[model samples]
Target: MTIRFAAVSACALLTLAACNRTQEPVAPASAAATPPVESPAIPAADPNALTAEGLGPVRIGMTRADLVKLWGEDSQPNAVGGPDPETCDEFHPAKAPADVMVMIQNGVLTRITLTRGATIKTDRGFGVGDSAMAIKQAYGGAIVAQPHKYQDAPAEDLFAWPHGGATTYVTDPAARGVRYEIGGDGKVMKVHAGDPSIQQVEGCL
Candidate 1:
């Protein structure tokens, strides 16, 4: 009788231990009831008449009249033999050299020439032979091109200065860099520092 009682007590204790071991743990109330966090609000940018960078405002497809309104008159036309009547051409006045060359056709702006000493700012990626409208689409305004001479292999080379009286397009005057050159033939000739001077044709009709 004593052995049976001891065995029954041992069996009861083992069952209790097994029950405790298999019980599920309770999660903290705080952790289970937590809410999601919200993000902070960002501030809006300031508006100004001039650009944030302090440069003047720029627009694309601006007409000759519109250009005159924005930049005033050109200092002087760069085209030799004075301005051409067949083509509308004007230079920004000395006070506002940024205007550069404004070319027009049938009273509509056709092309623009950026001289080496202008202040007009542009973002369009303009190259030589690009019409005024095309140039404005890529770059808003004209830029200066420094004085540079090309050295081609044959005297009859396309870029030979006098061949067509090359029109130098200054892409970044501040950097003293020229983007392209338009020959008299109205074709763009590559004029960079490389052998066989005329590298490739890059321009717009």
Candidate 2:
């Protein structure tokens, strides 16, 4: 009887242990979360003005001394290419575009030229590498289309006065204006803007 009681007590203990183990709750797994990053904003670039009046800060009537002030007088200006030695040589300034060339005659800024690689443009937004046909299409019938002095296929040298006057860039009291020199490819090779001095087919002889 004592042995049977001991066996019954052991069975009761085992059943209680099993019940306790099954009743215990399981813990959930934890995860780490990451946040998103924001990007910085960019500023807008300043617009440059090119017209018959001038090219950017260089005006048609500005004095040679004034140019020195703007372009830096680290080196003296060379003699202009035309008949007059007074004009400065077509040299590029560090501040100006790579293709830009400033011309001064009688100590006054007479012309500003734009060749390949220049980003600045006329108020009309015209610049080098533009098509001759594109220019005609944009300006309409007001432009004067001239034949290139050298090229045979495409009529290269094209002249226009978007400001509504037969302006001159030659000599004398040079008038305010601009001119476009296109190449055989029908694309503009040069964009000249300034006083009448800019009209010269070639720089001072």
Task: Using TM-score, give the best candidate's number.
Answer: 2
1-205 per-residue lDDT for model 1 (tens digits): 9999999999999999988896678876664666779788865433211111222332223455665676665555553412454453434334443424443443433334444443333223333343333432443333222223443322112222211223343232112222344333432332221111122221111
> Once superposed on the true structure, which residue ranges of model 1 sit more than 4 Å away at CA?
21-60, 76-87, 93-99, 117-179, 182-205
TM-score of each: 0.37, 0.66
Ten-residue segment with the worst summed lDDT in candidate 2?
Answer: 162-171
lDDT for each of the candidates? 0.36, 0.71
Cα RMSD, each candidate: 13.8, 10.9
Error of 2 at 171 (Å): 6.2
- Where's the lowest-lDDT run of ten residues in candidate 1? 196-205
* Candidate with the greatest lDDT versus the true structure: 2
State the local distance difference test value for candidate 1. 0.36
